[model samples]
Target: MNTLQHGFQLNYGNTDVMLLFEGQPDHLVPCTSQILLDSDLFLVAGRMVGHSFLHGGPALAGISEAVVDVLFGASPDMTTITVEDCPDLERRQTIQLLDGNKDLSEEEKDAVWKLADMWDLPGVTSDNRKWLFSRLLQHAVLGRTDKQIKQFRRGLKETCIWQLLTERKDVIPLMFPRERDVEIKPQMVLDQILWPLETTNEDEDYPVETRCRIAGYLREFIATASQSSLRGLVQFWTGWEVPSSDMQLEIVQGSLPKASTCFKSLRLPGHYTNFKDFSQDLNACVATCDTGFGLV
Candidate 1:
């Protein structure tokens, strides 16, 4: 039996095998026959053995033809593998293998999670977390049992999956629908409308259009809003003082023409003599009038 530097060896049973080490504090790692046979190391060792048999090489100088055939032929026995000493590399290889295998058994998945925990691995990487999330989402859409769904939710929360889900605008509503809330806050809806306008990278006119549309929406939203919601909207708009175009200002003012009335009627925060006084101050700070008298 000859040993190679790269952990390859020709065993007495005429099998070509490559030793694999896994995990930290390296030990002779044993694995299932299927895992060992399916591994890249085994494939590479088989190729090397076949190449050696086809062309006379120094590595095969003393090996018998029958031995070479057995090593190179189908149904090669890789069971007599020795322990190698590269635990970190082997562990990473195992992780990549497991991560790529979407059809893993429940036991296999448990093993993967255990390995991740042992390594203190954060599921922040796309490769590490995407598959798990995909599986969880599939289970959710397919109507898993309540207990199973809760387990998946717990796992996702532990990995900060909600933060990632928020970035996916399409999935956020599905995962966290407004209907789930006992009482949806008007500020949350307002924030949703304003967030894009504040963070947009488009031309300045885009924000003007967005703000005008938001103002119109708010006006309609407040019409059916609870007293508390109306108060919230008034309090929010009062602190906003960015200058806008005349058309944009006009549309926004048109939407909330009765904001001051609502504030006073509800006894909301902030003091204003009347709705006209509040409207004048807001319009002046937000945009100039047709007469060029208000702040531009």
Candidate 2:
């Protein structure tokens, strides 16, 4: 399941382009790939979703709501489409220009007209320009990708979770949450840490300053870390990119920051006197720790 998750979400370790869905991190909408469609990859994607859910794997969250709505039988008019779901930048830019500006500049009008002609969509009139904008958003997002969506639905049904997915619409948010819904926060990773006994001895007359300083550095790093950095931390501490409930932290006086994936524990060096050294070493370890036995 993790392997499947990596292939879809990370595109088999290549992020420059995708073979299936498109959009920002958590708002993915399927972009039509004729080659992949012919190969039935989307159907396989559907099965991945079902199997992942059943087997307790990745949530595969961030799927665009429009795609989720259609997967669960929403009609064209009923599906909620967002501008982000439009995979084409030019068309999306034109739609954005048309969204609220009824009095478009001549250049903007030309862009929209060009987009309409490009897609064979209805042309814009001064009065109907607003209507055109909405239709363009819908078309760019879902209209052109209808068959791909259907294939995804068919694949999902093959896993027999379609009924539950359709009947319990509330589960949509849980199954395929919005990007913001599942985005990792600094405190989230901090909460996952089981601080060492040395750091916990707050009332002691003499504290384990080495342990506390390194532990504090870890906390500080997480607090200011990028999304990818935190994800790397999770992937390092656990075998997967998701955080676990029982991650332990151990401070060793001379060792570098490393994790025991099977134990969900992070062992950090306790000798660091400054945040820069600590962060640099920690970042180096995280950068190369996503693969097997990756500790340096």
Candidate 3:
């Protein structure tokens, strides 16, 4: 396993130099490992509201859910980290680090901290998570879904950016056109809508097959997160008036447009009728888009 070199010096401010060891690095400084520091900083800020740090690059993507696992100290891999276990085997160590000076029980520690506070962290913990998740959701919507975390982390920022759309009424502009009753066909959803945004994707070409795979999974995530069917999720994405039932059939028959691709493999319902019912149910679902709301 790749490990931080012992006695390595990471200078912070003018007065601080963090000392890393083979076993565990000091919590005060940064490290080369993305998951370790990212997980630590998130818990510290969410629970204590004072500690913060700057993180960059792809490794620290999905810091919020990762840290929640560490703080609650549970190893169950769900939506956040897909691996059955963390590669570093530091989940236990991570828990110890976050327990800190508080005397409260571990479960109490988790119950007290909220995701909104996590978003408020004044350093890279908040910034990187925001950027990472924005990228991930963007890839999913635009048709570039990922199956493995190592790959999906690449689009974390783009994914979270799209999630921010539901944050308020104003987000309607960036995601949906100003006109009402505008129903975007799957192909049109790919070409006309998602690709235009340069900020959402990396500056490189993407294959259509890859885009389709991503979109399929992303659609499932929307249904799962929204707790509705495929149809309801589409309504949420477009903000347009509901299309006729026959129109829904036409859209379903067509290929997945490039506008809605992702890198992850999303679990979706089997048939068209089921998807329609799912959408109707999703439309009626209570709004649950709070930051980190669907992470589980």
Candidate 4:
């Protein structure tokens, strides 16, 4: 899914045309490309989004809400189209000029005129600029790309999620989450950790002080880690791109931090004398996982 997001940001075949999505990275809309459409890229992208949703993978974040509204079969009027939705900078700026009180010079108006002609819209007069702007915004963001949106919907239905999506409109935010839509906090990861009571300092049968210290270091690292670091830590701990319900973390007396992906358990060395050592070793452990390991 991460790779998919990166690929979605790129142009197709040096054409400056979008393959699956358009606009800025944070406000992407589906792109209409006949070549890609013939190859079923939109359908496959939608199916991947559905599959990721069903299998505890990352949400397809950064898609514009207006586009999402359209994706889920909402009327074009139901969405609020803005200049930001227009992918072309020159066109977006032109659309913005339509709203300003300053009259556009002939040069400024030329691009808008061409776009209007291309879309079969009437030439803009003071009285009609607003209407023309609305139509141009619609055509740029929605009208020209309606077919791609349809294929996206059809692809999602192929994954058997169309009914669920249509029936529950509220979960739309979760389906294509914005960064603000889902914030992963330190306490959230802490809460998910499955700790062994025996490793606590309160346990009398064993000298568990090292485990307690290492666990404190773990908490501090998690609390101070950046969002990307935290995400990678979670993935390393659980083999899940996103957080899961059962994250079993342990502190053993010897060795670098290790993990059992199948069990969603992360084992850290209890011998760490300081937070720096613990954090460094833990980061090293998370940074690499070329092979698998397990506890006997």
Candidate 5:
């Protein structure tokens, strides 16, 4: 907003019209309208008319000179001309002009469409413009099941969601699977069980904390899958501390179908007091699945 102030007032009536000279264009002096009057710099407005002689000046090249000349020529003198120039006007004008032109090929229009979308402009209105941009930026990174990812994608912009599925670039190498990893199968088993907990319908009613717990458990299970060994994965989640022996025994005693043979075989050295206690412990283990010993 800070700009040069005018230095003096000039009379448009007293100014003489001069013929536009073409040679040495760059050095050609700016139009009198370009000169600031009264305070510091030039002003363009209705007062300065018929000065098309200034049109060919090099200073006007690469500018909105044509538009400015057309709009302010008749009133240039009284126009409150500030000295600051808009640097992005030319590029913006080019984009606007490209969108306005209908003669471009479909392919060329697609490119322009992407540019407009990237710049967050309204000009790109092709039926699949938003979808196309999303696919182009897609990267598959997460190793989550397609269903889990579908949920994640639902929360993201349509244009960015496909990358997680199509590209598989979301999975970090450190977390990528390796051969002979028994933990992978077990983690898959855990995920298969936990995935059902994540199901939610738009019309279904549930407490906010329950939803958060489901999401947190799923994310934790996915994170733990990246570890190399069962002990390592369990340790990563359990923080290497042993779970309570009585709680482990109680988990073992629970006749619930949800409890796995693996949970029984690990011979967890603890007793859980009751079914409620066991269920709470199971949820806590998965909830704190990333924490040490699953105590949390």
Candidate 6:
């Protein structure tokens, strides 16, 4: 008989072996030496389950679920293995291993989710859950048929993930299109349409019809937006000096055609001159208006 490092005796066949319980310092358990020699059993040194047999002492901490099932025969009550039982192991490795397998199944994904939930793993946590949700949403959106997109959208609405769509700032355009009959706030729609127009390169390769549609959308939105929002938008895009409420209204009314004409002209080549003219017209309007305020 040879004693293993953790005070478990290794013996073959019918030989007697002694096992020490680190939790019970003074007690020893007797076992057939065949248990040590079982092909399915693997002994790992660390803490066992939730408790250490001996503080800072080598203990049998890691055991495969298969090994436990085989050792216990027909009944295995252990449902979970925690970090304390396998201090050297990381749950991410198991998830990654599962993810890498080309033949992954739904059951395997569920198992991964279960393990992540048990371990409180990062990939499945609240903060990172959006990554998974967005990928699924993207897959659905890019599906070949309108029926597929509509089906996926309907399915999503029935799940908790639908609530997350509203909370995601980066994916609003993907989830809600102006052409779609979905119910979305007007302000959100306006912001989405305006962002690319304001931020993108003027020479960028966006389709002219798209630009005209955005312009038309903006024109309609301005007609309905509160006077304060109109005033704010004018100051934001034109860098005009602040105007009194009456003058602000007048500026908004006068600028509507300039905005519309600029967007419509985008459909033609060399339309850059139209934008230049629009800017000059705006400056002339502002200067003429400023004279009435005695501030020119």
Query: Which ranges of candidate 5 are over 4 A from the true structure?
Result: 1-108, 112-183, 187-276, 289-295
In angstroms, how far off is 160's CA in candidate 2? 4.0
Per residue, candidate 1 scores C-alpha lDDT tens digits across 1-296 of 02222234535375566433122221212122344434434344334433432343212122212122222221213212111222345443445444443666666566556655554544323365655433332222221222322332343444444455546556433322232132335544444332223444554434454544545543455446664344333333332111111211222223223222212211111333344555454443333221232222
How high is the CA lDDT of each candidate model?
Answer: 0.34, 0.76, 0.29, 0.78, 0.30, 0.32
RMSD of each: 28.0, 5.0, 21.1, 4.3, 28.4, 28.1
Error of 6 at 179 (Å): 68
Task: Name the runs in model 1 displaced over 4 angstroms.
Answer: 1-182, 191-214, 222-296
Predicted candidate 2 versus true structure: per-residue lDDT over 86-201, tens digit per residue: 76777788889877755778898788888898888777886787778788888888888888888888888899888887778887677676656667898887887888675446
Cα distance off (Å), candidate 5, residue 6: 58
Give model 4 RMSD, 1 decimal.
4.3
Who wins the lDDT comparison? 4
Off by over 4 Å in 3: 1-188, 192-266, 271-276, 284-286, 291-296
Ranking by lDDT: 4, 2, 1, 6, 5, 3
Give TM per candidate.
0.15, 0.76, 0.16, 0.82, 0.19, 0.15
Pull out the clashing pairs in model 2: none
TM-score of decoy 6: 0.15
Q: Which stretches of candidate 4 lie over 4 Å from their true place?
A: 8-19, 22-26, 32-35, 199-207, 253-256, 284-296
Q: 17-133, model 5: which lDDT tens digit per residue?
A: 321111121221122232232221222311111121122101122122212321312233332321122123332333433433256567666665565556454444445444433
Off by over 4 Å in 6: 1-96, 99-103, 122-296
Clash count, predicted structure 1: 0
- Backbone collisions counted per model: 0, 0, 47, 0, 49, 1
Q: Write the per-residue lDDT of candidate 3 for residues 138-195, one digit (tens) a residue.
A: 2221211112222222232234442443344363332222222233344432332232
What is candidate 3's TM-score against the reference? 0.16
